[model samples]
Target: MAEERSKVAAIGTFASAADHAECRRLHRRYGTTYYFATQRFPAAIRRRVHALYGFVRVPDEWVDNPAHTNKDAQSRALSDYRAQLLRGLEGVRPEEPALRAFCDVVHEVRMPLEEPLLFLDAMQMDLTVDRYETYRDLRGYMRGSASAVGLMMCAALEAGDDPEMLAAAQALGEAMQLTNFLRDVAEDAARGRIYLPQEDLRSFGVTEDEIFSGVISDRFCNLMKFEIARARALYALADIGIPMLPPCAQKAVQLARVLYSRI
Candidate 1:
């Protein structure tokens, strides 16, 4: 039956990458701005790009998995990811389906060499740095982990290297990250990670316990305002850049950022 064949294909396609599902599952589970924007990509490109996100997500998982493991094993897992990524650059077929799909898109889309590479590089940085003391430190990590993604997505659109466009994209990327940092405060703290800048904490006279409690104090509210304002500014900046892309692409990116801003 045609229906049966369709069902079979869905299961077959999805099952191939079940081990690393967060990336695609995010597409399925949460149709937020990011995923919805992705849906607007060319169908073939969308699938390939989602696969690329999956590969990136798995490395993210190991660091935040909460399964609690020895450092050596975790190190090996990241090293494996680095190896897989490097292999993709050589035009090799990645054994992992996500990598396979990602490779196809990167090659066809001409995504920047550093977008995905820098993301992985940022993940490596995660294993070592848990606290950021300054805005510069945070920006450095965002450059690799978040800005790189924004740049890559633009690359997927074959946009020329317009500095203004790149700046807006990076701002949008950090806005998303800033939102995430607010929501995941408790969980990150559980894993011994604190994304709130040390200076901000000091300025507010808030300690780790105050963050873990989740009770809103005036200081806490003030601190949250600072982060939210940053996200808002980035969203504003992205508006300018979005118009530069194809109209549909611009809409998709707009939708994606708006959806995540809901967080």
Candidate 2:
């Protein structure tokens, strides 16, 4: 009995170690900026952050993969991924390495099950929605894709349920996501998706055709400038939340915020 128990414990230890390594690899490969910023965190918190990135990256890849030509296939794949995540969250070990690691973090932090579910919903939106009519409409999407991520990070840092901190975290998430949209305007247009609000395009006298053509006209430049200003404002708002985090977590969050804004 003792030998059998030892063997079982060894297997569990190996699995946990392997899952954490896989999470780190994924974060390093696809999330260079965020991964680097995580260096500021203590070892335990860094591992959880890596797992979080791995979890988010998997679903994001499902929607954004260039080779995924069929929307139906992508939808089905996303559904399967969501199912696997749900199972993992329910205490079943997920087969996928990233999901396994993420499940461990979820259990550790007691992360809300709804947060990952909401993120999956946003990825599903990418498959069906191609444009936003207004900033308000875009924010609805960000609530899932970005805001949930911030909330998850807060849980990982053990930042507690401070309402003001949560609000600022949401703002930080929006700021980073908006910066990404601006930087990837041409790339996203190539994929037949435009994250920029249609109303803003109209106001700036910019057209979808111009964006598709990669035209850097004064109008397009002006529109980008306006977006940059808006993102900066969010960064300012999010800055207030950093101080609310534990001393160890604050530096990492601040570094990520600064690095994303530089993008």
Candidate 3:
């Protein structure tokens, strides 16, 4: 009994160390802005944040990678990732260190499984959908891809279940996602993806051809400005929830919001 217990303890320690290291590596490589913001968090919270980032980064890469030109292949890969994530969430440690670490954090924080599941649903959409017909349509995607992430963060921060706070977090997530879409217009175009709402494009008289051709016409500029204004509005809403977080977590969240808005 003693020897078996010792073996189990050793495995736990090794897994914990490996998991943290993997999360750190993923965060450093893929999320410079977010990783920088995490530095302000208390040590325990920082590590958990890293784990969450790492968990999300894996499927994001699979979906976004230029080499995965085959939509069916991307779909299959995302499905596999979802399966592994679900297993991890259920307390079955996945082979991947990042997944394992994320599982540990989820279990530790008692995060709802539905949050990550919703994120996977968004990734699945990426496989089949390219353009959003309207802002409302885009919001549906964001609910899974972005808002779910915010809720997950709230769970990690132990911010309690306040309806207003969750709504603010959702707004913040949408704002950040919109900021990224604006900044990555060229990059996303190269990937044959357009995150901008089709309705907005039509309203601004910016054609898909203009976007694909990298034309920064006056119309395109106006469109971008409009989107930025919307994102800023969301950021304002998000700002209200910052003070609602525990004092120790408030600074990190504030820094992240400011930095993302700047981008």
Candidate 4:
């Protein structure tokens, strides 16, 4: 819990961003310390991370936004959002306010420009495709969406070239994503998004119909238990990467791991 506490401490700094104000607000809405942690980074690193956070906030907004009617609109919005982000990174003023501040972080960190954009690719997967056929499929989604962000953050700390470190960071990111999948199954299905592997559900004698029933059965509980167990495995793998980092950042990562997997 020490690490998670540090993340909580860091999240407190989010309120200071006047320019990327809405992004900060959105971060708060989804559970910041437990979900996104640029605010939870060390003070020296916080602002750049805040920009990363704001950049990330855009793709998330496009997916979770109520205004998105179907796959086409979502894809177009995400495509445009990503392009605008690139322009902002290149020092051009963006039409979107979120990208404006997000670009500042991009310049400040001088991070590998490919990471946050890869994250956009991940969310685009969510908007366009909802059914996962197997663990392999799910893992692919996690890699793009969450693992890419983790690897990029490692780069932010200048660990980009270190394959082992990035691997661990990716594990942590997947763990965080898996936790969200468990907690949000009900909410996700209501919105026509189902991330649980279809094969896993079938193997365990569960069905999509049961999921829609909203009734918690012994089978459903068992299914959740299996999913949580899988997420925990990823958390354990992520733990292998935490100790290699300097203090505050390590603590922040650990904190997010614990809180996100708390259920």
Candidate 5:
């Protein structure tokens, strides 16, 4: 029966039906725009992508809105998660299904462990660093958070070895991240975080008070326009790598790029 075949397919190499299902759920709930683009991918690739999203989202959540009020407790919990991820990468089966599935994808794609570690480092930084003095400073953080994730995705797509592809992927990731910072400015400000670089704020004559107070001044509008244009430039740079991807996978990536850029 079709149902039986589907059930059999659900038992992943490193995870179970429920595990992959959980990953899918997280991706759909939190990354709705991305989820739409992912649906265009082949089923196998979609599953792997979902697992990757879930793996990163867990740590991001811990740092962003932790259940524990104590900073030390939050740090310890993040460290524990990182340790488990390392163990999984070392061929030890993780007890958590998200880790299990993500590790399986890493092995299947021959992805390096360095990318995930870098991502964990970024999460740790979020605990202590809330504001960036310059775009370069923010970029340093994004190297571990956004660019590393793009590199991981490149590996997953079997295009990691190409330098050009990696460059473009990195640009794409940063562009998306910048978009997120711009969109979440108020929300992040409320949480005592400000992702926009201080230099840009100064250059545009926008102050933290205006941002925190939700004051949409002409200066703020100009600042946002400037940042939006910058994001679009990065998207343009990323476009160069699309043709390098396999024909079967190109459309999905393109769709994601288009949708995210629109946002």
Candidate 6:
């Protein structure tokens, strides 16, 4: 029984040991890259990170999987999941292991409830908005999906309300998310989602068909180059904030930044 508890120390009893165990399993199975970086964290922080990842990942899988039941079913699943999280945040124990574990961390760190809500809103957006017409449009989506998660992490790490740190964390989150979009362009395209901005494609003389057809035209290469450069710039911005984290946390976040930037 004790072996099934969280690997992180200082995890009291807000969530049952089984809840954290399930959260940890979700993180390890689906969040391979983030899970790699998480190992560098102090145990206390690592488990909370797992809980957070599990929380976001569950709703994401509900909507993202190509074989998902249907749009309405996915939407209903997300809504129901959000309701459970809301109850959990209000101090009622949730039946879902992921929500219960994440709520435990939220209460422990005094994280603002708004961040998770924003994340859920972004997930909701995924149901209806599959293609972004412009970089600005994509940024609007990312503000909730990526930036909010960064802000939540900043709170968890106790960055002490520093605007610079907050900005850097958001930049890092955006950078990582952009990297994922780049790496998964083919997969997301297969799912009928196009995260790359339409304007960028037009500017580079690439077309939706070219992306869908998986062509490696010079224009497509140029467009990818431009986006990769933009992602790197965000990573550079994130570097400025790493030093602001608690001493024990700096290494882990820096490693994550470095790993994602390499992609």
lDDT to native, each model: 0.72, 0.86, 0.86, 0.71, 0.85, 0.86
Candidate 6: where are CA atoms >4 Å away?
1-13
Question: Mind giving the per-residue lDDT tens digits that candidate 3 earns over 1-263?
Answer: 23211111111222478789988998998899999999999998998899899888988988888887888888888888777766555445677787788777776777777778888889999888889999999999999999999998998898999899999999999999999899999889898889999999999999999999999999999999999999999999999999999898999999999999998
Candidate 5 lDDT at 66 equals 34
- Residues 1-263 of candidate 1 have per-residue lDDT tens digits of 23211111111122245533544774565434567677777765566557666766677778777894566788787787766655655654456666655555666665555567678778888888899997778889999888887877776666668899989888888888888888898888888888889888888777878877766789888888887887898889887898887664776688788888888
TM-score of 3: 0.93
> Which has the higher lDDT value, candidate number 2 or candidate number 5?
2
Cα RMSD, model 1? 8.5
Which pairs of residues have clashing backbones in candidate 5?
Answer: none
lDDT of 4 by residue, 1-82 (tens): 2321111010111123576666566567755674365557776555545555667766786787667768788888888987
Give candidate 1 regions above 4 Å deviation.
1-23, 30-33
C-alpha positional error of residue 49 in candidate 6 after TM-score superposition, expressed in Å: 0.7
The pairs that clash in candidate 6 are none
Alpha-carbon shift of residue 174 in model 6 (angstroms) = 0.3
Where does candidate 6 have its weakest 10-residue lDDT segment? 1-10
Clashes of each: 1, 0, 0, 2, 0, 0
Winning model by lDDT: 2
TM-score of every model versus the real structure: 0.85, 0.93, 0.93, 0.85, 0.93, 0.93
Q: Which wins on lDDT, candidate 1 or candidate 5? A: 5
TM-score for model 2?
Answer: 0.93
Candidate 1 lDDT trough over 10 residues, lowest sum:
4-13
